[model samples]
Target: MATPGTAKRMWALDSPTFTVDKSLLLLGASGECTIPMPAFLIEHPKGLVLFDTGLVPAAATDPEGVYGPLAEHLGLSFLPEQTVDAQLEALGYKLSDIKYVIASHTHFDHTGGLYLFPDAQFYVGEGDMRFGFWPDPAGAGFFRQADIEPLRGRNVLEVPGVDHDVFGDGSVVILFTPGHTPGELSLLVRLPGRNFILTGDTVHLRDALTTIAPMPHDADTVQSLRSIRRLNLLRDSADATIWISHDPEDWAEFKHAPNCFE
Candidate 1:
């Protein structure tokens, strides 16, 4: 179901993560201190597609307000130098050229740079958007109103449930993988030479995939595990490489900055 004359390419941008102190409640049973955070860019003939927007460059200097909590949690002093715009520009593309912006979920980190593509159509799970706007009290601060307010009426594609072929061709598909966030979603891309499944927080680290470690916090533990299983099955069946959005090791393995996979 892939379209003709179109090539799919993937780019892994800067990678960053937050480490939880043992004093702070342990996340998984193993109680690992570090977690991986990554962002991706998808290149196609039609236009460029960005998976989850990493931290905004501005957050590095100020590290207060909305990012204050995140900064504290991460125990980092400065943010990474590679902003989404800079990374894309290095690859010979501009923010305006990105026609579609698909977010795995509406968490602040994932949606931070969404404002850069205000004109592009955003694809998100229908339930996720609703839950983001009215998240549970405990999860309210995770969704930033400023980041998502601009996308209200423009081209917002909301998928109800199940995996959706966004382009009606198998070239791009948005798969519903909830758990980390209420309406979390992942993408399955059929590239020319290879295939990839962008596992947006469905399975954070390689350990999670192999040992079934629990994420720090999840909307539903059972749903998250089920989603991970589904992704594993799809990856094995399609022979597609699974890219976890927040895996530093995986990010280091891919082409970075100007270089991309096509």
Candidate 2:
């Protein structure tokens, strides 16, 4: 592995396929749509890092347990191999090797594999830790107690709503782009040549940002719109490619693990 500053290899891991109402992804859109959940592996010289964990292993055999009724509602699909452990094994790595696990939010899809990396230093946005713990009961359905239980007293870093340089080098950064959730965090990766921005539900589909429409699941639509504007500015200023994690187009454009972005 190269040093933090020199670390450049990154792999994108896809979870089992999921289908959702297109309108749920982008307001005003209709029809059923399929999307892939993605997790990223970055081999930094300082330590191996994983960004977001796809669905839990149980999603394959016991979706009701992992996702409750939402599993069927979202049409969640899972294959045994889509588990983080399986994906890491296929990539020649183990959960024990991961030094840091940066979570975008506490959504089941993103935090499913969190418990599997108990040894890794966990990180989530500032307000989200508490929000996940005691979210508004009215809409707390999204915050599963099971997902929040594993993070009880672990080594979790609550990243402030600002740009956090993971390795103290600008190579990899956590961007605070809250909207979809109280403290949703996006990612900025500066590679040797091209730069990229990982939009974690901040902008679910291209149309959401392009049309200035926020998804229905957002905690704050106004704030979501503002966040999208911020992302747009960041994209234009840095000339970074915005990779919407759930966008089918992006899933097709980016290669899965074994194939990576260097």
Minimal lDDT window, size 10, model 1: 21-30
Candidate 1, pairs of clashing residues: 36-246, 38-246
Please list the residue runs of candidate 1 whose C-alpha ends up more than 4 Å from where it truly belongs after superposition.
1-6, 21-27, 30-36, 77-80
The most accurate candidate by TM-score is 2
Give candidate 2 regions above 4 Å deviation. Answer: 1-6
Instruction: List RMSD in Å for every model shown.
Output: 2.8, 2.7
- Quote the positional error of residue 77 for candidate 1 in Å: 5.5
Give candidate 2's whole-model lDDT.
Answer: 0.84
Q: What TM-score would each prediction reach against the true structure?
A: 0.87, 0.94
Worst 10-residue lDDT window, candidate 2: 1-10
Per-residue lDDT over 190-214 for candidate 2, one digit per residue giving the tens place of the 0 to 100 score: 7765678898888888888788888
Per-residue lDDT of 250 in model 2: 87
